[model samples]
Target chain A: MSAVLETRGLGHDYGSRKALDDVSLTLAPGEIVALLGPNGGGKSTLFRILSTVMDASRGEATIAGHDVRRAPADVRQALGVTFQAPSLDRKLTVRENLIHQGHLYGLRGPDLAKRVQVMLEAFGLTDRAGDYVETLSGGLARRADVAKSVLHRPRLLLLDEPSTGLDPAARRDLLRLLQRTRDESGTTCFLATHLFEEAEVCDRVAILDRGRLVALGRPADLVREVGGEVVKLTSDDPEGLAVAIRERFAMEAVVADGEVRMEREDGAALLTPLLAAFPDRILSATVARPGLSDVFFRRAGRAFEEGSDA
Target chain B: MRDQTWLPAFSLWQREMVRFVRQRSRVTGSLLTPVLFWLLFGAGYGGSFRPAGAPESSSFEYFLPGTVVLIVLFTAIFANISIIEDRREGFLQGVLVAPVSRLAIVMGKVLGGATLAILQAVLFLAVAVATRSAFSGGGPGPAGALEAAAALVLLSMGITALGFVFAWRVDSVQAFHGVMNLLLMPMWALSGALFPAAGAAPPIRVLMAINPTTYGLAMLRHGLGRDATGGPAPALAAAVTVGFAVLAVTAAVLVASKRRKTA
Candidate 1:
């Protein structure tokens, strides 16, 4: 499969503050990639540039072989986007909203009507077709939004945090629908999400922090890269414990929130010894398999939690 | 056959109509605000305050054109407010990512707003006609009323396009509301909607002369035969109104099409 989307050295800034700095990524046709990042990590800026809703400040991007800067209309024709916010007209019925969207894509007459019907049934919004969007539940409105985006049957789909406000069941439905969309229509789906669970389902995940791509790999690959357990120890004197740990293991430790954490290939084997070495200062110690958070910690040095001083 | 260029514009126009029906508060506000102003102001000002230009007209008769203008102004502002909300609400991002041209987007929205303004302005126009017959001793014939309605539509299209110029750039609805107050309120004040230009100070009169809605008000006044109010000929006013509508729409399209060049 060829690359359906590609970005090279994409950078953007709002005045003095840089939002995205020299980010590059690629996605194959029919692949689902999650852009995972905390808030203010430039996920939205990158998504906007890729969707051609906003131009990149100093880089290049192409969707479906059409350059975003030089041929935005062509890029638009090739992709569908579900925004982080609700886009439906609350005063209009679901069917009316879908039909209006269809018209914008130059669909009209019997064909437009038929597509509206198809989208309504696809999202299970058929019964609420004549009800105003404001009256629908949050999940149904979100489904209507996704349905509206895919009405044109574009080759790639971009959703900015589709599960932000959904219940678990609704989130599950969204996930299944996304996969079904890819399977049935051969659409490559890309979404920006802060939730690890949402990112775990993607075939590939790109982790961004501070406007840079810090890690990129399959979710499981990232977790397995530690090759061992992560040992986290809280101590009465974290500074003294960290110093003793560095002296004994000859390996650096990341200290965050009065706790010291380190990756250890033989963590289980050395746990008793490490505890003995720091018996006076050590308060508690736990060893666990690596998670996405551990992968982030490995790359960023800062704790995955926002409570870190960095 | 391919979808015609007007399809999107027509679709938006239909949506505006549907929303107008569903949202009763919007419908009530658009129709009632102008009438309330007219009645309260007309009764308070009384029938004796004819302007220097048209000395034979009653104050209520003179306020009729202004009432129609207010309806046009009110509806234009309220209808196009969706532009601001669409951005914060996400519908605009969907539109921005669509294959549709910028001209089509502006055209669809401006036309939709203009249609709604015209629809509501007609309701006020009917009340004006009835009041005129009861008090002014004369009113526009059927042909004249039709012409006045057309003028209201043209005026609505022009002012709504102007609304789009501000709305396309502002992200916040409150900021757009501020623009409406700081800019559109003055435009309406000098539009000869509240007072005739002949009675105003020279500078205020000049502002009225320069205001496009002033010409629209003149066109409506002449169509209804409310003594012409020292305005230019009806034909001249119509030309200016049409020219203003086209220019505002072109400006809006230009603003909407540009790709945030400052970035």
Candidate 2:
């Protein structure tokens, strides 16, 4: 089967500043992929471009075999988008929102009603179907937003920061709903998210930093690629300690937030050698297994939390 | 391909109607504010002034047609605020991402707003006619009322389209309000709504002549059987009204279809 989505050298610029640069990726049918990035990491820009709301300054993208820039109508027919902000009209009821969404996609009469009912039931919004969206809680509103997007049963679903305002339980429920929908309908899903937990749950995660796709793979595989264990040391002069450890030990070390971090095959073995080499420089030391944040730090040269606004 | 335009357009139009009906404040505010303006302006200018060339009538009657125009103007501004609201609330983005055409979205929103404005204008006109206030002594017959309704349809379409253009560009309702005050208010003030063009200075007369809104008010005045000496001819007013509506709709469609380089 052909790829559900594809991008080649996709780039966008906001005047002098670049939002997305030479980024490219692909997704297979029924796969759930997360475009993992912090704020201002070009995730929203990519989302806007893919959704056909904004034009890329450079490169090309396609959804379901139709070019996004040249054939937005076709792309729109095949794609459903959930924005980071709630898209349900506050004055409209949950069911009204779904029905309107169906009308936009050309589903009418009984067909539209049936699809809306199915979506409401699937999203657990049937009880709240007649309630105005403004009365809904954050999670309920998000479910309505998602339900509105998928009411037309597009082949691919794109969500921007789907878990931004969702509580932990709601987030879990959202993931389960998405998984069930994909499994049952074979609809490919792509989401842009800054939350590591959300990314970890996806079938694959694409780590983006400063408009660049630094890493893309399954969360476990990406973490494993960091190799062995991660060693962290907090010192009075973390920058100097990082350099000294790098030069003396011939190993790469990154300093972030007064802590120096390094990857080693046996982090425990490196701790003894580090203490022997610089007994006064090190204040505290820790050795742990690698995770997605470690992988992000290794690839992006910064912690995931150090994100600025877009 | 299927008829992609009207279904989505009608859906959007229907949504606008539902929203307007549900929001009681919008209905009351759009109607009440203009009536208040009409009453205050009529009382304030009652004994001191009478429009030149118009037949003998009370201040309240002189302001009736203008008040109807005011209701349509107020409704246009009031209804198109939903455009700003939809954008801020992210609902517009959802519609944009859908399979609907840009033209359909434009038609949906513009027509939706126009429909609301026209409905409110007609309601206000109906109340005036029923109360016998539309004409104190001599009034336009049924045919004139029909012509007035037709003129209002065109005027509301044009005014609502203009509002849509502004609402699409502004980011906040506050900013849209500022724009309406600065742009739309001046357009209404100089459109012969408050005063006849015959009494204005040459420069103001020039301004009135060029303003498209002047034609709308003239059309309204003619439909109401008022003396229209200071305004354009009835035929000219009708042509300009249609032209204005077409131009405004085109501008709205263009603005809606613009693609930005950044989100």
Q: Model 2 over residues A1-310: C-alpha lDDT tens digits?
A: 9999999999988988888999989999999998888888988899889999899999999999999999998999999998999898899888888888888888899978988888889889899999999999999998899888877777899999988878899999888988988988888889888888889989999999999999999998998888899999999999999999889988889886568988889999888889999999999999999988888888987887877443
RMSD after CA superposition, every candidate: 2.5, 2.1
As for candidate 1, its clashing pairs are none
In candidate 2, which residue ranges exceed 4 Å CA deviation?
A243-251, A269-284, A308-310
Q: Reference contacts recovered by each candidate, as fractions?
A: 0.79, 0.90
Task: State the lDDT of candidate 1 residue by residue for B1-263, as single tens digits.
Answer: 33535776677678777777877888767779888888887788786576787767666777878887888888888877878877777777777888877777877777777777776766666666665532356667887777787788788888999999998888788889898899888888888878878788999988888889888888888777666677777888989999999999899989988886333
Tens digits of per-residue lDDT, candidate 1, A162-234, equal 8888998999899888888888788999989988888888999998887889998899999898669888898
Q: What C-alpha lDDT do the candidate models reach, one value each?
A: 0.82, 0.87
Model 2 error, position A256 (Å): 2.7
> What i-RMS does each candidate reach, in Å?
2.4, 1.2
For candidate 2, give the DockQ.
0.81
**What local lDDT score does residue B64 receive in model 2, on the 0 to 100 scale?**
81
TM-score per model over all chains: 0.93, 0.95
